[model samples]
Target chain A: MVDDAVQRFCQQDLQLREALGAVIFGQPDAVDGATCALLAGGHLLLVGVPGTGKTKLAESLADSTGLSRGRIQFTPDLLPADILGGETLLPGSSGDRVEFRPGPVFTQLLIADEINRGTPRTQSALLEAMQEYSVTISSHRHRLDPLFSVIATRNPIEMEGTYPLPEAQRDRFLLEVQLHSPAPEVLTRIAAATTIETQMTATKVLEPKQIESMRQTVRRVIAADSVIDRAAHWVAATRPEDPTAPEPVRRGLRLGAGARALQALILSGKVEALRNGRTHLDDEDWKKWRHEVIRHRLVYSLEGELDGLGPEEIVSAVDRAVAHQG
Target chain B: MPASDSQISSRSRRRTPTGLRVPRLEPRLRAGRARILRHCSRRGAASGIAIGLPLATIIWLTDHDPGRAAFTAIGVGLLLATVFASRQRRRAATLWPRIWDRIIGSQSLIETILDRQQQPAGNPWLDALRARSAHLPLPSPTALRRHLPAPDPRPSLALTATAMLIGAVLGPFDPIPEVQLNQDSGSTSVAQISSELPTDEQLRSRQQRIRGREDAALALAGRPALEPLARQIRGLSPATTAPQSLLPRDLQAVQAALQRLAAGDPIIPEVALWNPLLALDSRSPMVTSAALPGDGASLALSTDPGNEAVTRSTALADGGSDRPTDLSPTPFDPQLSAAPIDSIQLAGTATDDASDLRLDTSVVTPPGEESAASWDRVRDDPQLAPRWSRVIDLYQLWIRGKEGSGGG
Candidate 1:
């Protein structure tokens, strides 16, 4: 028995997904992941090879959600101040006053492209804004928009001159959407659609305020103890030291998902339930999105890398082990 | 009004206080839980009975009374089934909501309702959820049965039936009693008859008897080569003459000795004939004698040589009496001729009739004829083989020759 409010929210969510899908061809998972991340009111981390429409997905997410979008092309020389604006002394009629200039992160949706290209020191600049939704510069605190969300993209193939995100920074992201290459048929459609004189753009489907309302509704969605227990079990299974951890996790991981990962899983699962027009969180809702919410938060050991144990494999193993326990 | 705004406003109205009416789904939830518990208990009881029947059959086969054992087994099975059902019911009570949710295909609606019941009221989401699930069907009995199917009792039932059938066919039977043989008794004293191994003393006694018989046979042959055996026989202890001491081989040896003695000389010593005859007659108390065929003289063979009646019979035969005396005594006692015979009157019959009161001794058959008649009766009997038959014939001839000499 879905509520009328949740039913309407589901309708808007469907529209938003359709608009994103129209803009970004053949990446329904990416579109859904991006939509769920926004609705969950958490940041997204897009990981794929270049030209897989990672940036397009981010832009489409912003466009479809009707959030003000800003783009930043991360470079090796970029500084923390470039991401979080600093206070500067401006010329005035009487006395020069230090005025704070908000950076691209201040926008509702900030697209940080090739985020790994930035140095670790510069890439960490968005952490405070992403987590606390506030930035501190020169002993002054600046609050970001309530709808502020960072949609960051990283090119997995471009390893040279790129600093990998530290565990702390990666933990701040709610989900990591991996965009795979389009199939041959999808590629033809992409090419035909993109080569047109007029470029296709995502139509706005949800206002920023409506998304906020939906976020509130997502919070109101019932999460029974059973769902929380399953989430706890899955999170516990990721740790190498946990009794429930599988052999793969114990052998292939140095660090596993933490409480934040559990929070992100349940939060995103709530939004997923609302999108499915349910007022309660289900095991399937969380299970379907577990990899996205937990994969990037895991830190693989040297042995794991040598054994070709990717985060996907580790997370999937933990999921299987936890599911088997249930 | 745009359809989208109208729909949004309508949804907004659902969040108001008026729309916060939580449906009464608890009764249905409780009913579903009870139904699941009942199903679980029934299945548990079925399983218990399936396991219990076979164990009871085993008890019955162990010599316990069939009716009592079967009743006790069924009682224990029911008791265990009750205990197991209680446990299953407890477990099912806790797990029913989740199971129901799974059955109804609701996304944890029943569980959410249950969880929400524990919290403070007035949650619109819970109310809306209840409203949504108000019309959701409780799992039917058919569905419950499908999910918690009864345990298959075929294998256990088959085993129990086979065991019961076996128990019926082979009813209660006594176990074999352990018998401890006496180490001291040279025989099984507790048993009326036993085929146990002979003790050391018994074996030694049988061996000595066999040796004595062998020496006697060699000596009676009267050959110069057998003189050493004859001397050995003269040196043996007289205790070897005990009839009970003779085994089957010893008896055969003694018979051969008598045959050899008769072949060497027609006359046999009286003592030699008496000793072997005593050994042969150990299992039977009767001693038989016959008169010479044409001399009209009789001989009486008796273990008690002092019996006057036998002496008188022998004297009469020596007197050349044509009528032979009855040497056959009553078969019950070999000494019946020497002892006075007593007769008891039948309780309900007349006591005054002299014919009924007195013993009939007037009708006498000659000993030779009686002996011939007895031989004819038993000559072809299985126990008397040709060898034994020949031994008896020899014994009768010796008796006749002894009688003929006495008459001369």
Candidate 2:
């Protein structure tokens, strides 16, 4: 009894996963997370060490989805005007006039590489476009493509000459896809494959309209009250001051995920349901992607940092607490 | 392809414009709820048996009726367990749908349908979900039974049965008898007082009476020959001052006096005969009057003359006595008086011979130390006079009273 649109989206989603998996060697979770973010019409933040293929994942996701791609290598000297275009003066045939020049962000899929290297002012420039799917240049609003999504990559090991993404900028992301180091077996395959003259590339598996239609179908996926309640409980358990918060969370976290995190969880869960050919959302759908959708939004306290508590530990504590409550 | 008007109307009729319909899932949910309640009741009953039987046994051990206690305790335990099971069932009612969904592997489709049933707008996805749920296999009754397994009653039943068996074997307890003592007077009864060994006050009163009788006997026996008789009486042991020994001692003293008379001594005056006769009749008021100082001088004068003349003058002098003439020799029977002395000697001989028997019976020991066999021997002894057996019985009662007072 699957809807035709959901069935079609599942078929396209399988091809997209295969296309991303070909180039991204061993990170299946990252591929699924990226696909889920894309299909939900939300931004994704890629976090991993160097040589773990964070940039490659962003690029492969853009290629596999067939969306118009744009790249921005963030640097310390990058300005807000460089990311979200500004007005410039030009000599016209009639008289001297000002013209609005579009930046690279006008594309459907924008890849912000080494996003943390940019200053706070430059990072904030993409926030509105990622959220509202529109850019405001000199009060002249410009709507983005219907399938606009940002796949930003950040190097976790490189702290030098980089500005950490602020809370406001981090919350704009629906999920932070963590790409782990490849296994030894996967590394041997990667070594033999990468040394060849022919480079690995992702072919387009889904059209832009199909992805937009999938996003609409994902939105239409029915989330029952129980699933929504479980998601709400999981997000609420992350806050340090919440009564339902576990001891580890109350001690290790300073700020919990907000309402936006709940929205991202249900929205991503719906996309996950569609990928699994389920017309209705289930608890498993939210539970499967809870860490990715919630880990980045949590802020650790000074004590927690001193105690070496991380976002992964906090999210795991929330998971155990919510499950025990059930 | 386009749908015909009739076909479109049929499709619209099949769909609920408001929300999704799950006709097949509700019955399964109801069955699951029933299974949950049944499981709760079984667990509650097991708990009730585990707690009730021991409580009933405790009540039975305290001398209460076993059947009544068991019935009351088990009834209360069952009532409480029923109430608790009902509460558990009510709390579990909301969880059956979730359990049903899990059992059937619907992946929360039932919950989704339930939630969708409240929504005003219908979605094609929800419609498709309902359609898919209709074809999903319903959970088998065996599966539901497995999901809610019956609580094991064997352990509880075994423990309860053991408790019941113990209660049946032990039966109701008998209450111990309590001893009551009268503390106000420091004594339980008059027989208790008489049967116990004499206290100092009683000893002094007996000694004073003996000394008065000795003085009257010395006044009446006014010859050198009678001095030896008085000395013999004085030589008797002081232990004979106890009331039980008084009768035997007096009899011995009178027998010694008659032996002196039979040894060719001059016949003593009638006043001398009064001492032995009055001693035998010590409870008579005439003996008390005869022992007065004025009667003693008259009795000494009566020893001075001829018998008839002296008896007449004594009767005139003792007219104030209740039985003045009865104390005279005219009323005395010599053979009858002598027969008592012979019987007294025989009784004393029998007592000496039965001393070994007394040791075997332990009748003379403290009543507290005496056993039932000792009391039976005392009662059955052929040689013990009825009067002495009665005295032993009173002695036993006195000892019991002493023990009671000490316990209190």
Candidate 3:
């Protein structure tokens, strides 16, 4: 039974780009990708040059999508207990015994702001809640809500005093959305809106039930075999070659994207197609998803110049190489 | 009917896997798991000599009226062993077909051999090496022996029980044969079975196997036997390393070769074969030529019959007999001719009248029900797959020859 409530609610899921920008502003693509990631039952990564308003976009998308916001400002010192909500026997005022006090990690939207700045030891604490949607602390495993998600962010320019993500950890994100500087016109509107007398707070449009139903609908968006095959081919082409070969492998690219890339590709493609109001994923759907699905996972060579090449550029090259190989 | 988004998967009807599951392995896996659990449970229940012991030792141990206890133990052990073996066999059987399919999936023998990456690593030597070993004489255990050595497989009483008994009795006074029969002597028998050399090719194979393990060779063949066995095969290793142990057959080979040379018959050292073989002529009963295949010392490996024109060779026989050896159809040299491809031919040589193995040429070229298709099915029996796989693997090993060359 298609509940009329869920059916009536997702009309806003159509013009979501505009609704998200009412609060986030200058991050239409990030908000679009994040919203789709939520609908597809996957996670999102918002990586950009610092001060690109990624946090603003995340907050607004959480609002426009009608999800309860759970904020976590990740730091080098943040403990797993603080984020994952471990069992601490806090004594009750009744003078009897203690009880478990869950942490902020229990919410639907877990915003790991500046996620990579935290140490891997601290960052990995969220990995369980990110993937299995669960946390195991002190041997008590608690599976989180099925609608639970993580919108993690990292800045690209800073190299020093930063705990940059290792290759293994970068592979977990569903979409590696790279937020560039907004165009001059968009920035002008952003500047005026921010400095204005009346500030805009996000308005909730989706209920908890609507969010759950939309997740299943997005999953039902059929992915064509050829489009997915092309996606897989590109990821495979990026693996490094052995040194003892007659000639060296042309690039020192580490092993290709993990299973998460396919996951991101399918989810992002579903969102892309649904934005155009199509039922199936197509070539254009993959074309839109290429950067979002692949960027962060494209680990380059040890060469200094190549290391600085944006993940977006490497992923594009990979796509072209795969098409050529095909 | 399409289930709605609100409908829970739990409420949906579950049926036997018509479309419910993947076609292969799922049901098989569940059944295999159940069998394993049952075997483990029996092993847990068994006491005395425990369970899963070898049939031969169990029978031999119980020879001296080993009563209800030994019989019960042997019965339980055999029951468990049969269960364990059938499961192991099934798993091994499943594994072989999968491996064969995998090898078939490979583009060439080179792809089969050096393609250890599971996917392409863009390595050249490994690619080339894999190409060459694909074409060798690989045999099946159906054409060889069936079973391997049956070890003493029973578990012992708890160490706590043994220690308590030892502490009560002044040192210890269990009957010598009764105490250690299943221990050192039973293990000795097991080791002997493993060390038993089936053929000269197998002898070389054993030599090759032990060339890396000196202490193991000494432990296997013993100090008295291994010392000289080690010296004879010093330069004979395919890996170029001599083992420090010996076997009885290897030493006997050296002694026979020395005796033949001293006697001064028409013995040629170039063929690298040394044995006191008494050969009989196909036509005449007197004349003999013991020249065989396998580096001129192993079994008869004939040519493949795919090609019509066989590349043939005929050796001149010069036995120290009054009758001159004559070539019937020769202008100046003997032109031997026959169908190739592992053929069956009658040859009378080194007639060991007491030998147990009845080497019928018929068995070598199996006929009837074992036609090519059925042969594949029979050949894939987990019991026989390793032997066939070995034959192919050895062909690759031969092609690669030395490690200093490729895949460094």
Candidate 4:
């Protein structure tokens, strides 16, 4: 039974999807993955080459969800303090006390553009705020809103001077949605629309309370033991070290997804099931969303790369193998 | 009790009739699995024979007994097919549960129903999953098989059958009968002939003696008393040693005569076949013998072993001839016949190019079934082809000799 809160959240999610579709033109999967990441209250990573509208899509997410948005354009020289904020001395009535000036990470929605352009040290600074939902500057912790979400974008690693995101930083993202160049029809539509100054603004479809409430409703979704078993099996199958790893993983992978991947899979599956007007998780939900949720978390072996095994192929192999498992 | 549409729908939604129930699904799943296993076994048997027969035929071609080699090939093929079939069956059996999981998971009702069976959620919201997947379709094994492609063994079987038939009929595996004509006088019959051919000197001497005697017999044909018999003998002679259609039959008759001669008998069962009386459609006939009733010291004048031509000559001298050849009296050997041939050249005709004649002595026989039955013939029968038996004996000896030389 879909409760009133879940119903409202699903309706709002559909409205947000429609709104993003109007502006994004052809990237329905990317928009849906981002929405799911937002509803699940986890970070999203948008991976694509430049000029694919990854940044515009993130901006649209911020606009469509009615959340206060802030952006950080990561570069090689970016520092931790730049993202987590710094304290400034302010004279009060009684004495001088240090006031924390929050960085761009303080807003309800933060879009870190070209995140891989930042060095690992700079990237690690967002880890605490992303996982703990709070930033600590000089032992003073500043809490973020319950609706806080990070939608990050990165250029293809082959681009010159771009740093690759480490496995740990990549694992923090709930979903890695790949963006592609628009098809001919969508490109034609985009060209036709952009000829004149058409300042297209997305309609705000959800509030902070609604997002938080939807997360609560998603948490209440029932995930059966068998569904959990399949999820665990799938996650374990990614690890090449495990004896039970699927054939592809055994041959191509050096490292597998950890327990965190399983948690994300099950949690995202619950959200997926709830959004589809169901209050219980099924393997279908897990199978459908697993590639996005777990792809970034996987570490393929050098041999796997040399053999031209992509994360999508590896994940699909595991999916097919697990689906055939007793 | 009367109920509203909502209540009726909700009631029906809680347990969709077609949703998988563990109790019911187990047996159906097992049956589905059994069907797959049966299919594998059936496919293994059909394809195994198809593959085995041809493979066995190939094995037979290496100068092996056609019967035994074929059986070995078939046995080996079936063994391999069985192993592969069982492996496939086990694989299908092991994977069925995962297949069931996906099938059950597809139906929200099945998943919900299974969850309720395992652990019932008290919240009505969670219970609603049953209704969400209530209308989801359930699949049957036939439907699944239709969706998934399984290999059709029929085409493979037909191809294999064709291959096996071709292998049996035309492959080198069949026996090529090598008719080594032991024309030497010392070599009495096939059974008495040694495996090795006569040396060149012995062959030359024997050939010369036989040629000289034949010349003398030709000269003696001018005598009025021997003219008819000489004409008959000339008519019986092969027009050429290059085997003609009549040669084998003639050779078989000669072989029967030699077999009887080797047995030290005066009469051969095949004597009736060579009798000129039979060929001439003459009613009057008499058996001839080299030793007349009263002359034991006289040498038999017949060149052909076991023929009663000398007895016929003596009868003509006595002027009595009124009987079928089958009733002809048995002959006697005075040991004065021309020496047996040393080497009866089995020659083929030369082309118009005037090239030296080359003979193809190897006579190919059809492939026999390589099965338990054919192997039994090889093992148990005494009348099987001597060449095949000799080859088998030589193979066994070679194996033994190799083992001995290897110091095993």
**lDDT by candidate, in order shown:** 0.71, 0.68, 0.52, 0.62
Q: What residue pairs clash in candidate 3, if any at all?
A: B52-B77, B109-B130, B110-B130, B110-B131, B226-B246, B303-B341, B304-B341, B305-B341
Angstrom error at residue B184, model 3: 99
TM-scores across all candidates? 0.65, 0.63, 0.42, 0.51
Superposed Cα deviation of residue A294, candidate 2 (Å): 1.8
Which candidate do you rate higher for lDDT, 3 or 4? 4
As a whole number from 0 to 100, the lDDT of residue B301 in candidate 1 is 38
- Weakest ten-residue segment in model 2 chain B by summed lDDT: B340-349
| The candidate that achieves the highest lDDT relative to the unseen native structure | 1
Clashing pairs in 2: none
After superposition on all C-alphas, the RMSD of every candidate to the true structure, in Å, is 19.7, 21.1, 34.9, 24.1
Report the CAPRI category for model 4. Answer: incorrect
lDDT of 1 by residue, B298-392 (tens): 32333233443444434433442443333233232323323332211111111122122121222222343445556544544564445444444
Error of 2 at A249 (Å): 1.3
Model 3: residues with Cα > 4 Å off, grouped in runs? A1-10, A92-96, A241-252, A304-308, B1-408
Stronger candidate by DockQ (1 vs 2)? 2
Q: Rank the candidates by lDDT, best first.
A: 1, 2, 4, 3
Give the CA lDDT, 0 to 100, for residue A188 in model 3: 83
TM-score, B chain alone, candidates in order? 0.37, 0.33, 0.16, 0.27
A135-206, model 3: which lDDT tens digit per residue? 887787887888888888888787776797776667777877778888898878888888889877667776
